[model samples]
Target: MGDTNSDSPTASPEAAFEAPPTATVSLREDQLQNAVSFLSHPKVRSSAVEQKRQFLQRKGLTDAEIEEAFRRVPEAPAAAYVPAPSPHSVVAVPAGTVTPAGYVPVQQQQLVPAQPQPVRWGQAMLGAAFVAAGVYALKVVVWPYVADAVTKWKASQGEMAEAKALQEKESNALAEAIQAQTSELRNTVELLQKLTVSLEASVAESKRAAQDSLSLADLRAELRTLAGTIREQRPAAAPPAPSVDVGRELASIKQLLANGVGT
Candidate 1:
């Protein structure tokens, strides 16, 4: 049976495989848009051509979702894909200037007349003579007053400048005096502070010394009272002569007893 099966014709793997599917997998509209946007990227456009489903998978889409999206992409019309115009390539003409093909540009309004006619040479010469006369009169009559006014203004300005300089000098001197006074005040304050600190220390020392002296005086007084009390508590013994007489008498008695009493 094995030898007979081996001899029989076997189907090739390629022949057994199913044909390429024509029907696209159904996908969401948004997924289809995402696939189109990914392909529209400059880097994706320049990359080696691959299956659209694989490209969608690279864009973080699931395999099943990519298959669904790929199905709908073929249905999208090629004419619907419009290339984005470059900013530098597109030029805009003014709407009023551009006329449609075979379009008659009807007049919107009648044109206004040009500016008034040019003046004659005689009138120009007369106007120039009047200006020259006015200039000459102003030079003879008004110029001296103007010059005087300008000179006065300059003199006043100089006086003001001098006054300002004097005021600035005075201010500087005053500032220096104030600074010196402030330094002197600071030194005086420091000296007074030192004196005050020393005085406070001396006072404290004096207070401590006074307290110690009071304590010493109280101790001395206590010692004097204790000495007086001890002196008062001491018993006064009888006269030393009587003590000697008693001792002599006791010695006489002892001699008599040694001699034998009655005999």
Candidate 2:
């Protein structure tokens, strides 16, 4: 138990001499200032940036604003622009460079197209006269002639109507004349019929007279026979019957009657 205790590990002098010391190399104020000055140099420009400090001091830029500006810094973009003219007008400007021409006032030129030549009073009057003449001709000569022709045509038509009426009247008169002629012809035929009847009556009367004459002749012949018989039978009575040749006496009487009838 004593050996076990003597063999147990414990801190020794050589082990202590081998152990590390806790001594620190503390920085001095001059050394720290020298290091800060070296880093802050304009050429090196480290340690929170002397450039940012100088820029904030000289140009009134904050450190965060300067960092933002530096971060945004890229190569400048190329652009085409016309610069305003210098206040002193120098002769070194290139040919086509523009100045502040917009600021200057300019008077606009009054532009008017050329007016066509006006028609002369005489020519215009002549054109108007021609139109008026045409209108006058239409109203006076042409229209009147046309109207006269229409009137004449109407008159001719009226006359033709009159002539047609006259013709119709004449035709009616002709019809009346023809009807009268026909009536006259009918009357003439009636007269001819009456004449024929009269002629027939006259013929009947002539035949009756002939029959009467025959009967009278027969009675006379019988009387002559009786006279002859009486004369023969009786003695010559009363002066020999006047020596009567009856035949000769009858012939003389007939001759007298014939002469009277002729008269």
Candidate 3:
């Protein structure tokens, strides 16, 4: 049986592990010298080791290079103290010696002042000429290109503005044209609708007039049939009476009908 508990003291076969190999980088001589110079600076030397390491790392130096530079940095020398002589001290002299005229004591001798050096006018003029030449070169070689670039940029901006304005104007004109077309189309539709209504009214009136004409024609035919029947029923013993003429009455009715048709 095998122990399943996590705290079991059973030991398994030992597994040997090998450490990964460290990579080494070779540095240039100038790089090492530069790092040494940085470490030797008074301000940098006064800082803590961690601060110095961080500064060197910011300057692209690896840990190995930084350690080597710290080793190469020169140590600052210790300050020394010297005692000054007292102003009240007396000079010792021999018993029978006579003092020389205009002789000063060794301690009272004054230091000579340093003389000022004269300025060279030729070197000063040469430096001024170099400055003037540099100014002229800048004006001749660099200024024109800068001015041309500025002018081209301004021109491109103006062109873009003009193009935008033109596009806006075209859009406005197109919108107006479309609005006018729509109004015209609407007016045309209204006119057509009015004409259609008028035509329908005219067709209805024509139908009514035709119906009236047919009724009048039927009345005229019935009147003629009644007159023919009266003629056939007249007696043969009595003479024909001239007071009432059926034919004349029928003629008058026909004339009235003709007038109504004309109207």
Q: How well does candidate 1 match the true structure in TM-score terms?
A: 0.39
lDDT of 1 by residue, 129-175 (tens): 99999999999999999999999999999999999999999999999
What's the lDDT for residue 8 in model 1? 25
Candidate 2 per-residue lDDT, tens place, 1-263, comes to: 11222222342211111112244234322222222333333333422455444633343333454444444432234577989765444455456977675645334455678999987999999999999999987898789888999999999999999999999999999999999999999999999999999999999999978876776676567667967885686554456554466566666767755654453
Model 3 CA deviation exceeding 4 Å by range: 1-124, 203-263
Better of 2 and 3 by lDDT: 3
**Highest lDDT model number:** 3
* lDDT, candidate 3, 1-263, per-residue tens: 11122122232111111121254347544446566655555555666778867866766667787778778875565568777766655576687988899766566455678889799999999999999999999999999999999999999999999999999999999999999999999999999999999999999999989877986887678777867776777656645563256667777878877776775
Candidates in descending TM-score order = 1, 3, 2
Between candidates 1 and 3, which one is better according to TM-score? 1
The candidate that achieves the highest TM-score relative to the unseen native structure: 1
lDDT agreement with native, every candidate: 0.62, 0.58, 0.70
In model 1, where is the ten-residue run with the lowest total lDDT?
11-20
Q: Give the candidates in order of lDDT, highest first.
A: 3, 1, 2
TM-score of each: 0.39, 0.35, 0.36
TM-score of 3: 0.36
After superposing all C-alphas onto the true structure, candidate 2 shows an RMSD in angstroms of 32.0
